[model samples]
Target: MSNTETSPQGSQPDTPGPHSPEPPDAAPKARGLLRSSALVGLMTMLSRVMGLIRDVVVANYFGAGSSADAFFVAFKIPNFLRRLFAEGAFSQAFVPVLSEYRSLKDLAAVKHLVDRVAGSLGLVLIVVTLLGVLGAPVLAAIFAPGFYMNDPLRYGLAVDMLRFTFPYLLLISLTALAGSILNSYERFAVPAFTPVLLNLSLIGAAIWMQPLFQQPVMALAIGVLIAGSAQLLFQLPFLWRIQLLPAPTLGFRDEGVRRILKLMIPALFGVSVSQINLLLDTLLASFLQTGSVSWLYYSDRLAELPLGVFGIAIATVILPSLSRRHAEKSTEHFSRTLDWAMRMVLLIGLPAAMALLVLAEPLIATLFHYGEMADRDVTMAAMSLRAYACGLLAFMLIKVLAPGYFSRQDTKTPVKIGIVAMVVNMVLNLILIWPLAHAGLALATTLSAFLNAGLLLRGLLKEGVFTWQSGWFKWLLQVGVANLAMIGFLLLLAGSAEQWLRFDMWQRVSHMAVLVGGGATVYLLVLLITGMRLRHLRH
Candidate 1:
């Protein structure tokens, strides 16, 4: 609780030389951001690939049936909260404050903050996990009421799975805490790579442990629990290597803990409005049809790949730098960093969204149209996938834009904007669900995200914190031409959804690989032809 400064125990200085005060020029900062983003993107890409494989395995075994629906809901409940609390709000809040301590205070003070926060956060997660396990049935009933009222078998299965999966919140939340610390020090790889462990654990469970359970789907719930433990354990050694392993101590009265809670409380809603919208989709999807939940799940997973890889990677790399810039009061640098992130978002996000929009059916069919998954399921999932794809740009924008506020520790404005967006999403959901069913719900989320991103961007611009740099018009033109070329190439090459379905797994994989690789090549080549050099991206 003391404000006094103290140095760390090692021979090393409190502030490392590599993370010294920012350079005067924007070029070096831009290069560092690009390098860090690439590293995080690579690690995140690996995790996303593993995640797609895990989903494929689940689809092969469970398909879009009552059990798959049940498992998705049960796993979604904790995973949803994990995003809302741990990764979303907690990370957004913790990183900026940690950066401030790292910048202004000594290493010992940083360690104190880490220890107290760990204890406070860990204790809360333990209690929440207990409540979640005990209240699994009630949670199942609340999250998927249609299952409770109309399908008791599915309802019971959800409850049983929830008990096993709910504890994941505790474990994964702790992992996120450790990750936040490592990321603050610019150790982006360890935290970004940690998710691959979860994907691997779930794949192993589905392949090997499914036969061990009578229900079979129960293995996935066990997998969630195992992955959480492994993810948390995997990061501890890295934390020790950094010499900042948390020694947990209750610090409810600590000043640093109080500040984090203050920022975190509002951020729970502000930073995670998109997630809240998705959860709303699940809540409503529960009542739509037998396969509605699974349809949304499959489609959303495909949409998440680009978002997680590029959108999140860019955001993750920038937040610490943004926080440091803010701490240093480098106003121009902060604005330029945000500008660079937006350009990257457009450069990557636009083409990715367009490709998904054009190839939704082929992508879904190729990845998930095997084994227990049926033709109807593939078609329906593609419909929702396209809808989610429509909003991918907004989703990516929000990832970059929200940090504009959080890096400055300004949480209230985003929360207000989030509330308005959430309300609009609920209204859109009601109006669309009756006509479009599950895809309507996906569309509603898409619309709300655009609103969220728009509002966040407007707030930053109005405050004069983010001024557009020169060449935006030319940059946008290049991106637009590149995306048009990519989309045209993809549409021409991607055959009908039925054709994709008829192909064997190897054929689907090979053809899809060609389409992806070929489309990317065209996009990049067009950009190069349009005179977009690497230096343009360096701000």
Candidate 2:
């Protein structure tokens, strides 16, 4: 239903007046957005794969018990903040503004903007981190209130770990600042690959550092801090190569920093509704069974694999391109870019979601059912995984659609939509949790994601900023058929959860590999047969 005929590589408007300078000659070419996205996806895939290994290591050592629950709560607090503040809100606000400055101003002005923003952000995060570490008990109570009532020892452990992990908030936010600057410059790979350090660090900590600590969970907290520093340090050389290495200077009064802060205040809620819902789920889940938090954590990680590799990758690449398009006032190109991204989301997202739903048990069994992980834990995690999988497409769609608003400096609209979705999620949580327990928490999150994505799409349509591409119906039909074919193939191959549990780790891994490879092959073949082709992927 969209006007796909208009190229994403849109023609420039007339020469702009002094107030609105022309886009830089070095701005990323629109046609290359897909290639850039592919690069980011591949890099993210590596990171996500390493992250899975990290989780497997943790699960093997800790399993789904009180210590694991405490550690997850401790980690989730900062990890949630990392996404909400660092990657979600900060990057969303900073990148568009940074892109505009780079396109319109001189390199010196761009460098100054980076320095001032970094200084301001660093100062704020320092205060927040200090408060978090000093007030660890109160912070833990606020995030995992059930800890107070259910198990006092778990609450105590979480408080102790929070002090160790809270510093990661400051470190990773700085890393995100660096990543944002690199992304705006169209140097996407460095930021995309930075996550690998975090995963590798955690893996090492779980494997080697655990024996050194009286409490093994403390090892992961140490890993987080080291990874945060390493990830931040890793991006500096790339920034220096591009001559945007920020010289940190106190610039709270600077115009650009002020603009970013102003945008960030609202954009925080606007960009992070999904995270908020998940955090809420964590809070509520903490009051459930002892291992409820750990179950949700593992399942959420599996769902996030596709979302990271595909959804976030597309969003990351497009935000800069969309910002450039908006800077140039190329409305046609903006719409077409959104159109292209939406198609990519469906083309990949549907199959990925289907695969996750069908193979949830196999994945959980292969990845986490070893050492300390029990069969009951595997079964519980799979339920949550399938629930999260149901909302995968919506989650991925939100990733792409949000940038459409953010790039235009329109933060207010998404804030309103986000608020509505949050309220709806809370109401749904109460309604669903009684019946479904931890799995219900996940289902509520997924259902809320649908609400959020729907509102975002509706807003875009109502404002006439996005139109459905003309071939959407036919495209949907093709994707649906392909998904059904893929699902059927998977269901035929995938055995019961008990069957998966009966296998040794090597057997489970081998079976999963075949099912995954064959499912992808069948899905691709069906899509090709239904008239989808490689050229359709391009602008």
Per-candidate TM-score against the hidden true structure:
0.96, 0.95
Q: What is the Cα-based lDDT of residue 299 in candidate 2? A: 99
Candidate 2 lDDT over residue span 451-519, tens digit each: 999999999999987887788898999999999999999999899988999999789989999999999
lDDT of 1: 0.90
Candidate 2 wrong stretches, greater than 4 Å: 1-31
lDDT, candidate 1, 1-539, per-residue tens: 11011123211322333434443334234447888788889889999999999999999999999999999999999999999999999999999999898777766888899999999999999999999999999999999999999999999999999999999999999999999988876677888989999999999999999999999999999999999999999988777766789999999999999999999989988999999999999999999889999999999999999999999999998898888889889899999999999999999898889999999988998899989999999999999999999999999999999999999999999999999999999999999999999999999999999999999999999999999988899988999998889988998999898899899999999999999999999999999999988877764
- Each model's lDDT comes to 0.90, 0.88
What TM-score, to 2 decimals, does candidate 2 have? Answer: 0.95
Number of the top candidate by lDDT? Answer: 1
lDDT for model 2, please. Answer: 0.88
Please report how far candidate 2 places residue 313 from its true position, in Å.
Answer: 0.2
